[model samples]
Target: MAVAAAFTLPLVVPARAAAPAQAAEVAAKPGSPSPAFKTVGLRTQLNWMQAMPDTMPLAQMSIPGTHETMAFYGTAFAEAQEFKESPQKSLTMQLDAGIRALDIRVHPQGGVDGDRLHIWHGAADQKAELGSGVLGPLRDWLGKHPSETVLMNLSVEGTVDPSYCPGQDTASCMSGYFKEYVGPGKQYASLFWAPSVQGSSRAETPTLDKARGKVVLNVYRNSAGNPYSGWGLNYGTDAGYKAQVQDEYKVGTPSAITTKWNQVQAFLATTRTKRAGNLPYYNFLSGTGIPFLTPSDVAGGGSTGSGDPTDPPTYFTGVNERALGFLRTDSGERTGVMMMDYPGYGLIDEIIRHNPTSRAGTAVEQNGQLNAFVRASDGNLVRSYLPYDAQGTQGPWVQETVGATLKAPKMAGNPVATVRNDKTVDVFYRSDEGHLIEAWRPPGGTWQYADFSTSGYAPATIAGDPAVVNHNGVIRVFSRNPANNHLMESVLPTQGSTAGRWEKWDHADVTGAPQIFSSATAVVRQDKTVDVIYRTADNRVNHSYLAPGSSWKQELIPTEPPKGEGKLGEVAGDLSVVAQGSTISVFSRDAATNHLTESLLTGGVWVHTDVTAETNAPELSGSPVAALRSDNTLDVYYRSKDGHLIEAWLNSGSGTWQQFDFSNPVYHYAPPQIAGDPAIAIRPGKVSVFTQSGTGSHLTESWLTTSTWTNWDMTADNRAPVLG
Candidate 1:
């Protein structure tokens, strides 16, 4: 007759009614984090642990046409509903890997109670052995006592005969075979399993099984013990065993090794054929009349074979992949998607990996149409093709059209800049004829495009970074009008009778053309106020602000006073502004003395201070970038004259800039483009900076958190699409 089994066993009462209080406690504790579980004092533990050869680790047990192996080492818990419920209980062992051969034993509060349980070679075959190799007479007693939780475990064992190699020289990573039995020459064996359950598990093993398997778990190897050797043991519940050793592992003589090797040597002497990383081990846990069975699942496909559990360190740990563009935003659903997509389709799921942040907005691709396919800061595929003919309407994100023919622009190309509000987003780019065009999203619809192209306005060429912001429920767009040397601001209403239409244009009270005079930067503060920093034609940094609904308030902040009134040549100033409460702090790199100065707004009064001495008193020339941390601390990332990324932070609530060198700066990359326009964003504990790399257009992003600084060079210079 053919026999079958279930996934888990039935909970049975061995004697009296099982207590409910203990079960309730166990259920409650499951919700909270606990230490790793450990099993001890099982009468069977001492005997079964002793019965198994110390040198040979049971790793893989196989059936016909299939081989199942343990993926990692899980905690062995001694479970009981209550202390008085059943003293004669046994624990069951379940494996994440496939089950093949099982070694079972019974420990009667005193008498011998164990069974080999049932054995099978395939799905259809079963062999029940009750007398030899496992179960004794007490096996029947174990079956009658259902309340006893069995301490069941599987010991996967393998056979490693030197003949398998036959004098081969080349061995695979994590797997080494003896070419020929030499004198006292040493051989390496590998035992891999999970060290902890919470983190990703990795391991390495060898096999003649042809198919390479996934890295094994709980990597264990025997070595000549050294006192300084790093020996890590991870066990217990999730909150349980946590041990760390730094630079503890060092090479030493065989005699200096620990006793674990001696125990391994003794086991090897008697059980040379049964080495670690071989055959699988299975244990019998009490179950319904039908037991829960685990079949053989190999790491790699093919004949389930095993390898040396003792391998070198290089084969186990290293950088595997890179994470990028972690952004947060509101989603139509709860737990909105946190995207990490790049221009190269190198998108990875980062949803909820870290706690969500309220300050950042979700990133989405503008749309699959035109150049709109770029990924947003938030990480969603923003299809901006939605129809937003009416204001207050937003569109849905649709999938890209497969094999669809893409059309070029109707006339000339239009250069545009886009920004998103709470729910709506708008873009305004220069069209073919130098006229500005607008596209925006309404309340609940897609983006609608409009050409606000006008006739000849002026002969002046507009040149400067355009600024966009959502203030007081009104969307505003500003750009420099080089003709009249003025800052032009346009209002796009979010809740208007004609939602997608713009109200009218207003002129800001600040202006300067780079080619004609000095440099300037305009930024909108969090308080719905506008602040602009510029270098006057006299070579000094100056600051000005646009009040809620008033004119600009200009303040002069000088590094080195000009000898005369007007200065020659274009004086460039690298300026950045961030708002803290109602005040705005503007930092600028002065052109004359190559120093940094700051201007602050306190209770409507502007205070100018020379902050260069606090920033390491270093020479500066290029543009500086800044981002606000959760602590409300402003971290400034900048490029030195030598073209390396440097950092400075306002240590105290007061605006005192303290220079702090970045840990992992691009020290060796030649011709570093740190001087280029630097961009920064602060989210949670992480701050990311995007800058050009070594005079190349490829953007290299470096991230800094409390722990470490990581960098990833965007895409290679090759424009070809990455082939899968």
Candidate 2:
């Protein structure tokens, strides 16, 4: 298809013998190394020729008005390690496999005057005899083949120039001659085109495709446009010349590269793809807390509260554990919570009280049922049986065997769940698709999991944050639905089977819109009726009752006093409802300030009270857990804004609030669940509270005994534990 030269370089070629005789003694000396080819005195000129297979037919192709050599050297000779060791002795030659010779006459001055380099391939030594100024033959040869390689030597014929000399003896003049050779096809052919007189520098392409690994052409330029030429070889063809320049040398990445040069530059861009992986990274701030723990610790501690002296408010102490999970029981047995500690990472060093001999289950996502507790076990705590269920039941929790371990789908973030118990224990969790799911350990049987909503009903929109409640014998799951601007709930059988049906109730009809509503908070009252309390968008506490079998009844827990108490009342988002007898009490931080507000259902109506007024108002979040104290009063615990757990309670059934200085302030106090609800039997009287600690390590619990708060402790199981 195309006409070009084929150059198969000789393994060891001898230079022209006659021209080197004058410097033969110098050449005979130990050849230090062949001098690297330079571009100072080199020049290039292209020519055309008829295609030929071998050197049996060659034509003389020399530039007109130029006596300089275009010494073509392959990358092999130029980059050979041996070239470095012996630059003076190494022979630099290009193959002439496809050049043919032509019979020509030689003049004394040795001038073959022509219009252009001849491009006619006939024999390796083909030449035409002509006097110094015959240009017609050269033009005829050029017309024949317009594309071919034509190299020549640079030097005067008979003697060296003297008058315009740059100061050189005979040695320099004698070493000026070089041989010319045409190249092969696109792959095995390349040239060292130098545009200079001193042979000091030049650009080169590899002789073979394999020799050139990945070529990246970066054309550096000033105001004159691209300064680098001969960059087309990087793209394997001339089609990429302009593209290669625009990509590497241009200011911005243009939408399209229009020229062959640019395409070549784009081809070269592959070379820069891997440089990003070679940079350094900072190692200091990446690990656990190396900086200050909190602002107060860094700024020299200052008092945060000005409550009373006998019962001063304190900040939360940090409580965290790892490799521990929370578990509950069917008899509602102390809502049995268990966890395991690896013991290596500050396990025994902290106030962790669980035995070291426990077998932990896997840490799975949305797998709140990984609950293994130290029940009334016949064996040691280490041998405590973990309850799982193959079928739904009300007692003796059994493991659900599945093809693979239960895990949250890949894209979900920190999938978690909490278990609540009535007749049977059920785990309520938010699925990866943002729908509530209930997996139950049926009484005396295996576990069964089901989606909370039916397909034909209203679509369920579950919030990532969810809470569950076991009321009387019914298990209720609560979640926020942003679609309809309301909190939603689904209920299940609380006494026997694990299967449950979800019933959706609009908060608007339940709480009445225009009156803002808070997120969902449900409590299984002592009377077995469900009391769901929440804050309206207007920051008022609203209550909805699912009384026995009756329809949902909604009412606003009035915070406005009987027109006498000069203080104003407000309700916050984290609403909590607890029923003690007919007096259902709702707790939440006041909207006006970070203070706790209590609404008591008295005389078939709700009444409001501020427990923080007697003591100083402490910051609180989430719903506070309430437990009937040994004194028959209500003790409430919650987290404050300063990141500490605090407690305040009614001293008596008469509604007189009193603050107590329990134990050290805990760092983070999640919504806590009281173990001794009036419905359960083995009532410890002592309030056990479960919450995630500030360290974010594991769940921790604190117990109140004999009117005093005790140190926090993690369970024996290693999975992260949570309270429902």
Candidate 3:
């Protein structure tokens, strides 16, 4: 599975749930706002949720006095019944507002001659029926719109009144009724697309195209009696249903509701990961038992203790509001089916947005233009070019498979590339055999390959990606020897020397093993010294360097000690280093907070600073990348917590930092989700950034020209692109 960032949203707990009388008082207040209705229009996308029409409010469908039995149970029971989970709108209304997942509790009652299935909520006062009430209308609507799908979870709930199921076994009767009314033989049978229950695991649910005008019937229980058992997906066990409030009548406090909501969120977090070949995940974001709050409570009811009826508690406004926060924070993890009460309150819009999609990894730029080198899905190295004309107008991006004849395995780490003095590009990646493979192209020439294992005394296995840099005229490639975890260096032959060959340095650093997921970053100082920074196994950022021709030396960048006495938590991701004049700044993500932290190597000491704190931005979602602009100012780019691209820059003159959101305005349709660390290149007034789109993992580029931003979809599924 592709590693991606998980979305999470936070929920705020209210003070308390209002008493029944207080709720009534709040609802009766004059000048109360009119009830809010479902308003999200029909969806243009092809998804079960997007295609269904709105549903009628649950409250409007229930027959008055239907809750008499529950009310007879006492005050607590009666109060719970008052908190109506159903909305006032119809199914079509909810569908219009974006409700795709339906929670139906069918009781064998309310059909013609009193022998039919009716939608039941365990309340006697509520009326139920299959055809005109719910199933029939749903079928009719689906017929009108064949491009949509619905997930209907039919379960036998409430009392099986003999008047409703007069004949055989109740479960079998209900199942037979469903088949007779909505099965393929029915008038709307063509609209029923029974997803195969066998081999359901690993089989992706049909896409919108395949599921259009289809009903994904989920027989929650009594599947043995379901005539359509083999036709639709069914789970023998009731594992998918999660109740937000186990005893709705007892949930009288807002904190209790908050706790339940958190439970649902936690359940989703874990279940999403384990959702392989299982029944679709479903979340019931509605509360039961507490009956004092009605559908009107959502928008009108006041707090219990507060006398001002107009100041109603938020819990009364709608359960959907409580769920919005979670959905907002949901990081596109697969949220199978989210069922809600009063869903039209804009909650469905948020849920629909959390659909997960693949995105491209890191990206790089070359020759002041954007160039991406990716290991294709087929294990081929591919390059994409986004060329800009002399007029500053960008051209269409072109992509080609590079080193196609090599038949290399998919690279384990992002490929790194550097430009030689002859303008040739040298790209380095670790081959499947753990050998460091270098693919280079001479000016307008075909690519050539060199294997380090065959060249010299290089280690047969390298643990991670290699970093390359051009020092004066020599091309130095740095990697980690997996055997001893020691840093290794191999130097490519100088520009035009036919006698020169790739050779490994005789010495290995004693800085311990570098993190397998991190690669060394090399920067050459004006004084001819080469400085390389990497994370050590001890969870410390170590700087290893060679002063001119001096022996290699390693030093740990000082970090703030932990509260009691333990080393700082492990570094979260890779380290980025950039040098301007004599100042070298190293950027890394703090494992504890995921915030961007910086260490300045000035003089001979390292000073630590919290870069994100100064900028007041959220914790970064990916590794950070930095580039030195023409003005000598430092510009850092990183993905924000929301999967949008953000840039923080230092004002060269004032030395103050400012941040900008690069993804919101232009890439809002699909934010630039950094699958890998982003790459940056600078030219005069231009700053080009390359990132992988989280939606499709495609190569995406955004550059700033005179403060204006322009973007391009460069290529698809390339490991973070590197600039050469």
Candidate 4:
């Protein structure tokens, strides 16, 4: 979020004691050997924010102006409210406290003849309390710490003497004064970090190695003649500053401050996700408000007099506390430059914790392997995967729920899984909050949850299960945007600085929920194109897909039946689509008759085909799932109405349908039972089907290899399984 480069009169009364003695121990004068200057063991262990040049304090180091010299003092103006925002410490102390940015507001102290520069806050002179001469100490500090950099933002805050530059104008006079103050033979000659400034529209972040022990000056308002005038860096304009002043006066309640903090958090999250990495992002965490005080109360001696001693502390304290909480929940994402008020009492440390480097090596590694993700009876996402022992022998399939305490009772349908380009497995599910939640395990890394709500594109409007497919390293997600019941697609970044950014597309306009069992399915074709199929709101099957360099186009799957077959009836449950070679087919169950229906995309048009014609096609009790075999043949699995498992396949050469009964009453300890939707996965030479028992108390698995069928109970009391 951009902060207006202007100052307003406000006081942050110190309601708490000073920070611990350790904070003061590192506070040493320039050129002194301080413990804070010591380099840590590793660069990764350091706070990334501290390494960036843009991190800074909100105001320049200044001493409080006394009531006698203060312009607004007396006459109902409380002296306690005058200089509370000014820093009591020197520049040396601020530098040691890990503050790399400095806000220096310079104005002409004497008349046109006077060459001295004095720092002022509004009408009050701060030269006495803060240092009178600022450049000397700042120059000395750079000489001592050659590895640290500081960003000095110089601006003209108050009125400047018109006679300083005669007809040259205020901009020229300010520019001339800055140059003479820090130019060659001046107070800071050969001290400023001039190379840090860029002349291009995009200013690159200076590397630490090049900017070590340097002072980067940013003049907010420079003359046209100045080489650094159009640095292209964003600076607060007069109009923006005026707007901010008006906003400050309008917000008078603590709740307004809370609302502003929420805006800041949202802005921070967006910046973290979309930042270009060329320049640092900054946020001013302070808000202007009088939550505890009103004009009537302040008029009745409530601020200065002890009549209203029971009033709460100033609004600044509340903002600071909220900022601290935001930083904690930010979870180590880079929070650019955070210009803050009262940046003491261990607040710098809290801000530094947001540096990404501080979180290096924190991601749990999952190692290379595919895992099955399913929702357990307890409403927790569970993972079931095969483990290998020391001798390379496969161990029993282990089942464990992820983040056991986190519940997903509102999860719709089954979680979908896909393998990323790096061979890591990602599982996507709808959370109870109607947001897309992803749990992924990187190769050699443990499982990690990528909550889309925080990672950028959060469509809380999602109404049903999401379908995910990874094509050529890009993970694409398709979900129904409940707002319009239109399908929405989001593509994950494949690589580079924008790697984690989720680029969302316009709604694909496929029918979404109100039908609880309806969901979309997607598959990647051989040419890296994507084919998606779903049940429309009219209970008709529709196909939408995207080819390379093309937009998504939709077409009806021709489910109207072949002339005399009558209507196929409504789609009962979720649709499944699979691609084999150049052929793409969709499978669904008829709502009215429970008859499994199939559609083949031939020559860009869908051709409805019946899987069972001569033989009796068992009525389906659940959605049908399809998988392509190694020989380019299709295998379909579904639960039968009699609570038995059935499979259908097509003859590779003749394109004829055949059925196989996997439920054997003699082999089972009890009568064979099946429930819910079945998931299919193809291995090297076999096809595996995972389903839940009729009682929904056990997870069963059936596989077909060669001509033999094997069945076993995988686990108990697990939801419908999703194979990766």
Number of the top lDDT candidate:
3
Each prediction's total of clashing residue pairs, residues at least 3 apart in sequence or on different chains, is: 86, 111, 62, 12
Tens digits of per-residue lDDT for model 4 on 121-167?
45555553113345666667767655456666555556666665688
Q: In candidate 3, which residue ranges exceed 4 Å CA deviation?
A: 1-370, 377-379, 386-396, 403-408, 431-435, 451-461, 481-484, 493-499, 505-517, 560-570, 666-675, 715-724
TM-score for candidate 3: 0.52
Runs off by more than 4 Å, candidate 4: 1-370, 405-412, 454-456, 495-499, 509-517, 560-569, 667-671, 716-724
Q: State how far residue 714 of model 4 sits from its true place (Å).
A: 1.8
- Angstrom error of the Cα, residue 657, model 2: value is 2.0
Q: Could you report the Cα RMSD, in angstroms, for every candidate shown? A: 28.1, 35.1, 15.0, 25.6
Please give the CA lDDT of all the candidate structures.
Answer: 0.31, 0.32, 0.52, 0.50
Q: What TM value does model 4 have?
A: 0.46
Ranking by TM-score: 3, 4, 2, 1
lDDT order of candidates, best first?
A: 3, 4, 2, 1
Q: Which stretches of candidate 2 lie over 4 Å from their true place?
A: 1-404, 408-422, 453-458, 467-472, 493-501, 507-517, 524-528, 548-550, 563-568, 621-623, 629-631, 653-655, 661-682, 705-709, 715-724
Error of 3 at 32 (Å): 49
